[model samples]
Target: MKKAIIALALLASAGIQAQDIYTPGEGEGIIYFLPKTQIVVDIIATRVDYKPGEFGLYANRYLRLNNVSTRPETHWEIKDIQVRTAGIPDSTKAYIMKLKDKSLESNIELTDQGIAKAINTTSSYKEEQPEYKLQIPQKHENAHQYMTEDILVAGSSAKMAELTAREIYNIRESKNAILRGQADTMPKDGASLKLIISQLDKQERALTESFTGVTDRTDKVFTFTVNPEDKMSDKVFARFSSRLGVLQADNLAGDPISISISNSSSLPAPVEDGKKKKKIDGVIYNIPGKGKVSVSFQGKIKWENELQITQFGYTEVLVDGLFDKKVNTRVVFNPVTGGVIKIDKD
Candidate 1:
């Protein structure tokens, strides 16, 4: 879709009320929207599952494996946490740009959400959502895939376990022989020798895992969106359990994971004058306030950073007469923070 000016109307004079410039659903002019910052938290957790081997009971006797677990088990762990910011259109900050001259129409640029990105200059804003992905474990080969014909067709579980253990030892011996350069027929190169040893090690591990069991792991991401207007202390956003992994905040299955926000804005608090203050009439933009955000789990801080929060700060406007036909002005805005990036006039 075309992304720029929506509608335009010539203003009679510059003495217009500031409220008229931003009042919703009013005049026919270029309707543009300001942006608000949204905090995104991505939690990555890993789930581990262990499957007991079919011949686990005979593992200790045949392979000398000690304390091999015969029961299946499942558990979860928090691997990582990532924080990012996204911009969304703020309906309350929508405004209309009514200019006396229509010559600047061709130089305006805006995002799809009607957030002003640049005027009389090039902008690199691409209206796209963030990408998320979850990784899953791949299927692993079964012990039978690496078993010898005699071992596969063994009459009893005890015999099969012994035969498998012998095969694993054989693979290990072959790898050692190649590594020691004592094999009857050696590989032509170091790369070939490495490949042969790696295959042998893989086959040995598959055979051994049949007795010791196998643990499979997969990673999943959980996302939470936050919009902050003030300071927040120890707000529980999610939970984590060793048995269930990530859970909702209301879920009692896990322990609480919290987030804390502290406003660090340098802007003075707004004063209430007896007369009502009007919204600015000129090129309006935000002077975003700074804030520190942190995440904690299990009584320990995990991640923290400072970010620009559009809601914490006040708004300001460029001086009048900057957009006149006689002046050549260029302005670039940070849509995420609603703050001006650059301003130039010739």
Candidate 2:
């Protein structure tokens, strides 16, 4: 009879233990297991906006654990956290604000699945209520914003696994000088281990960024110049000169201007002996007072393929009698098309 009673008590205890097990997406808010930990966490955020060129995320978390073992009661504490930006290549620009405690450790892990899980689980978490609002001048035309809060709870066994994986990964891939050789040499439960793990997380974040290819390309050089006075001499030159001078001072203050010039003649056929023929259509010049001068050539010539001008001209007259003049005297000719590729001021 005593043995039956003891068996019932043990079964009841096991039932309680089963109920205490933490499962991903089981509790309220955004809570998930950290690889191999018994920690249960809840995360909440509000007014989160996901937009191109503009994004904002605010989150808060709470953590706790249930003691179900007969051994010395164990307490679980959130020692650190790891947040990742996943999927979209450069979507990690949004910064975490007001980290609860600076002394708390943090890391960024880069498994392909880590980000995907976070994003997918985001919808399961509840949005947090707003505490306050501030009036600020709007900078972007269409900027969206939001706020959030969260909670996290974990168990002792799970927490141990989290620590173990972090240690192993740190020892293998971490680049921190202090963590070198110390992974195996340091006391397992000491503060040094925590510090090393924190550094490892930071290094992981940098590695993820490198792999995402988020660095902008800003080293390419592009340069071109125009001449407004070339090939202009008569009424055509006067009108164009006045228009360009006024446009530069008003509409073209910060704009790219397009210039197009083509020959108005045709080229003759090639002669016998298989030698390539040459054709001169017209000469384009940059005369300061004449604007742009286009002298047409005679005969049936292929102007597009033969006679081409190198330099164009530009002129800007100032109200104080100071003339702002620019000339494209250097011509980059394309041999295949017999055309000008680029023109610049000499």
Candidate 3:
């Protein structure tokens, strides 16, 4: 929890055989575990993607125009649900990708103030004026008017990971100078860094608490339905998507936020479980690949660090089927802190 010395000890007991897996500047933080969703498959073996419904990224603001309170109401299900604790920025302040497909745009319009806007269609353009007013309808042999979309809003993506990691570090750095100044007995740059640090910590803490307080961790759940012909099963699905909620957004920089989703049954068995006495283990993995990984994690503490490093908590496992040969790596993480600790892989 202090510095390199403590981390080194944790490494030794953790027993990770892979390389070091720590980010440079990210400090301690909370890692909120969102509820997991179930995906039903057709017992097939093939890559797949699915989307259940729509998702929105919104910001909250209350205003009193003419001394009258005015803030549009939100869905009762998500009234005042915290998406980004620091408040979402206007279009230019941050990267806003409303929809994934370049051709398709966000159906949910927004005002310059970050409020929802009405959706309307543009008049059909014409190269020439119509000779007469008329109406026409195209006919199809057996076509049904349904709809389709290209983006999987809820699944994990590189952009989402980058945003999450940056936000976590932002929360850390925002309070870094304050703590440093307190130790020196001189304000950071001779300014009231303590006050700033206190404010930032409060906002970060509230954002974090909001994540743990969510009532609908997983909703609109159905199944990870797959192609009827492709073999699909719990074993065959091969974890194609994952997401970890971030409490807020900040401008600070840090390493990419990475995580592996797993269940109790999926955790790896201890190396000598069947033949020898049980030993302490680390509860983290450092996976570099993006495809399916047989992730297993838990903790008993006192885990041995095979990397000859002084890391306090650690464990290792071999990840295979990530394109080709297996990769050797070890990692450890504290759920209470949003730190990945390590995501190393050979």
Among all candidates shown, the one with the greatest TM-score: 1
TM-score per model over all chains = 0.87, 0.16, 0.15
> What overall lDDT goes with each candidate model?
0.78, 0.23, 0.25
Predicted model with the maximum lDDT = 1
Q: How many Å off is the CA of 166 in candidate 3?
A: 2.4
What is the TM-score (0 to 1) of candidate 1?
0.87
Among all windows of 10 consecutive residues in model 1, the one with the lowest summed lDDT is: 10-19
Candidates 1 and 2 compared: the better one by TM-score is 1
Q: What is the lDDT of residue 112 in candidate 1?
A: 71
The segments of candidate 2 whose C-alpha lies over 4 angstroms from its true place after superposition are 1-181, 185-203, 206-254, 258-346
Tens-place lDDT digits, model 3, residues 244-282: 211111312211211222222233334554676443222
- Which residue pairs in model 1 clash with each other? 7-29
lDDT of 1 at 251: 99
Better of 1 and 2 by lDDT: 1
Better of 1 and 3 by TM-score: 1
Q: Order the candidates by lDDT, highest first.
A: 1, 3, 2
Q: What ranges in model 1 sit over 4 Å off?
A: 6-21, 102-107, 126-135, 267-280
Give the per-residue lDDT of model 1 (tens digit) for 1-346.
Answer: 2345434433122334322445544555566677888888899898999998877998888888899999999999898888777779988887666544534533567787777888777876554665656667766667898998999899998889889888988888888888899999999998998889888878987888888888888888889888875679988999999998899999988999998888898878667788976565476788888889999999999899988888888778775557655787888888888888888888
